[model samples]
Target: MKQLYISFILLSLSFSNSYAYQNKTTKAVDKIVVTKKTQPTKTPIKISNAIIANFVNKYPNLKTYRSDLNNLYLKRNYKSIWFGGKGLIEFANLLYAKTNELEQEGLQSKFAYKNKINSIFTEKTTKNLASVDTELLLSAMYLFYAQKVYKGIESDKIKEIGWLIPQKNLSYATLLSYLLVDPKALDKNDTAQFNQYYKLREVLKKYRKIEQNGGWNKIVRDTLVFELKPGDSSQTIGQIRQRLATTGDLHSDSKSNRYDQELIDGVINFKKRNGYNEDPVITFSQISRMNIPIENYIKTIMVNMERCRWIDPEMTKAAQYIIVNIPSYKLFFVRNGKTELESNVFVGGTMNETVIFSGNINYMVFSPYWNIPTSIVQSEIKTALEQNKNYLVENEMESIKGRVRQKPGPKNPLGKVKFIFPNSNDIYLHGSPSKSLFQSEYRAYSHGCINVNKSEELAYLILKDNTEWPVERIKSAMEGGKEITCMLKEKLPVHMGYFTAWVSDSGEISFFNDIYERDDRLAEILFSEDYN
Candidate 1:
């Protein structure tokens, strides 16, 4: 009986000890899960279904980002991303810093829910971990930034301004994938936006700094066309030197009230940059442009930077292409990244603003006929015919298929040749009879088409590769006294755009007249929030 009691007591003690150890082990497991909730670990914590559901309900417009976020968490089983035991994740901090400096990236919009993301750091404590929603918020803001900066303003918004170059489509999901592997790719992946946009951003910073530092003095408008020859002494000369020096057109301001050779050279450089006739004389018209405030220049740079963001950098890398800047009244022919030829061009008049678009030039016509549009016929030609019965005979025009068209001759408005790029706008690049307009500083005198100053030369260069159209044949056809059309062996792309401010490949900046007054309309939209 004594042996049986001792054995029962021993067995009871063993049972109690085993139960206590099991209870302790369960508590230890619970503690491990609780600790991991505040820090990153190999094991992940389950986020409440309510957190994601609530975020989705609140920000329905972020459906794409929300879907991405759900997939991201689904892959990791809903573990925290923007939070760890130390508090906010390193990537979250880096992205926040970058978002705060949006202006440096040529962006002016406010980040959504910025304060809430910031509060994660500001309100963090030893007892409190980051909110479950913090990761979603950061991810959402990142998507917004990527869309705005990389994709630029929506296609419809740019189409309102007649830009139809087909904005490049970007994938934010790809960006997220990169960040998943290497978070630092946010800084390294510059291909998201056009390379020119970043270049313009650097220039924007410099212009803004200049504006902040009191900028250049506005030249007092004078009625007299000041033609300051060398050795001419006047207070206006000193002021001109000072103004040019501010823009780096002059190395230094001599401060001597004389038109020294240095001032003359500076004027020529200024004229060339501004698309003037390259004459050393400073006319009243030129001075009027010079008096424009530096703040306006800064605004021009900003607006043009926005325009740059809309371009696809890859388009600039085409094997052969032609680009025309309406404001600058210039055309560039590029092949294999080298400028083959440049020509002075005349864009549309203010009343008939030239469209901004791209097309492929597939054919050329030598000694083309000017087919007068029905609108001009009903409006102006009818009146001219009423005044003079022999108007068609005098103008070398004849009725062809019930339409009055000018014959292909020397007197025809389309001088000798025309390049055809099919578009709905009926716009073509052609030579003009009024060659004197090319010599002028401002050449916005066209009805709607572009007038190429070197059309014959452009034709020769474009067709030189084909044995069918040799240089002699091209020249002979241009002056052959009859209309001849030649289809190109290979089509070339042509892009017509409006840029009031342009930064060249060599980093030289040039300003052009806003002939169509587009800058103000675009500025109104860009700075709409500020005005409000």
Candidate 2:
């Protein structure tokens, strides 16, 4: 009995010690005491559930949401606590969608999470939401969503793939290449399309890098020695060196008359191959073409290309259309994809910069009356009247309710027929009596109106095919001294644009002076470190 009691007590003591240890272990595991450094608390944004629901409905594909998404975006409340995080996530998601790669899912998710956490800090939100960067991000997001929705239901893979292409880079060459090739062999499955899309993404990425590094902007000026035969080198080389030295091509051995003509000839041959004028005298322009920085040139191209994409692509295919390159001060009229008419135009000056826009030409006015803009009346007429009372009469001007107007005549400020496109700016394309102004490189003299030299011929050409009236009839109508609105059978599209630098149809890159100083301003805004 004593032995039994001692053994029972020993067993009970062992059980009690084991239970005590187990209890301690349970306490340690159950009550995890993590002491994190206290962070500044953010005030939660007050947003309406209705607004949240509406936003979700509008952007149904946007999977993630935050309380501040509505407040920050819809309400434009930058002070919202969750603004930064939500915006970042949205931006990251947008970029990921644009990549169209399944492999990027992991990275996209990580960014999305980081973006959410960063929003808690008010300081970060304020910094990121500065300028129009947020607007651009939102625009990109919307575009990506639209693309995805469009692609989802598309049955034709080639057609869908073609639609997926960024229209900004759809040059004549690229378009021709795509149009010529059949995308039937290319994979139509989502995975395959995604892979191909990634390949294009990679190409665009490398191209972007090359463009950013000024690869296209570098101009290498050299003279072409067309006199050289394929195998024969000496005479061709001598001619090249002579021309290089004369034209001041860089690296010309001034001392050595007997220079490497072969190298010079090779460069000339290369220039000829690249679609440049085969001139023996290499000018600065020629050199610029050779060594042009790709990034700078590409940016210029891309900007204009974006402008092109903004317009309906079908407009480009019209049988007849007019385009006024604002920066170049040139007008191009294309008929069935062929340039039928090309002319120099005088656009608005620096202070009164011509707007970049696209509009439809509704009618052409024969012997149109010049309705002076109110701004012109206030600035020019008022000042002219102050200088001389007889100024209006001397200039063949008529007074109409405290406003001066010019009568339509050869000597009138507006030469003849005016192509009127109703716009808020009260600007139009008209013939100019002062045709000499068009010859000037810096032609910005008009009061926010475009002056076309061959307006009559242009009008006749535009109306000839579609209208019943012959050129003689149109001339007679103008000669009758009456303003008649000739309605076009087919309303043509007009694109007035500003592009300081552009690649010509011949593939020669050309740069023009930013007469309105717009290019510099845009460049500063686009490429500046603090712009974002």
Clashing pairs for model 1 are: none
Each candidate's TM vs. the true structure?
A: 0.83, 0.51
lDDT (tens digit, per residue) of candidate 2 on 1-532: 9999999999999989966644443233213221111232244444444645654565454434434244334433433321343333222322323233322111111222224223322233433332122332343343333233212222243232222222222222232123225322122222213222323333334445654553332222235543333344444335444444332243453433343454455456545434343444444444444444445444554333323222334556768888887767788889988988887788887677777666678888777677777887887788988999998888777888876677777766666678877777667787887877776656666667788988877888887675488878888867656667788777787777665645544443345655766544444433444321
Q: What is the C-alpha lDDT of each candidate?
A: 0.76, 0.51
For candidate 1, lDDT tens digit of each residue in 370-438? 999999899989999999999999999999888989998889888899999999999999998788879
Model 2 CA deviation exceeding 4 Å by range: 1-295, 517-532
TM-score of predicted model 2?
A: 0.51
Clashes of 2: 23
In terms of lDDT, model 1 sits at: 0.76
In model 2, what is the error at residue 403, expressed in angstroms? 2.6
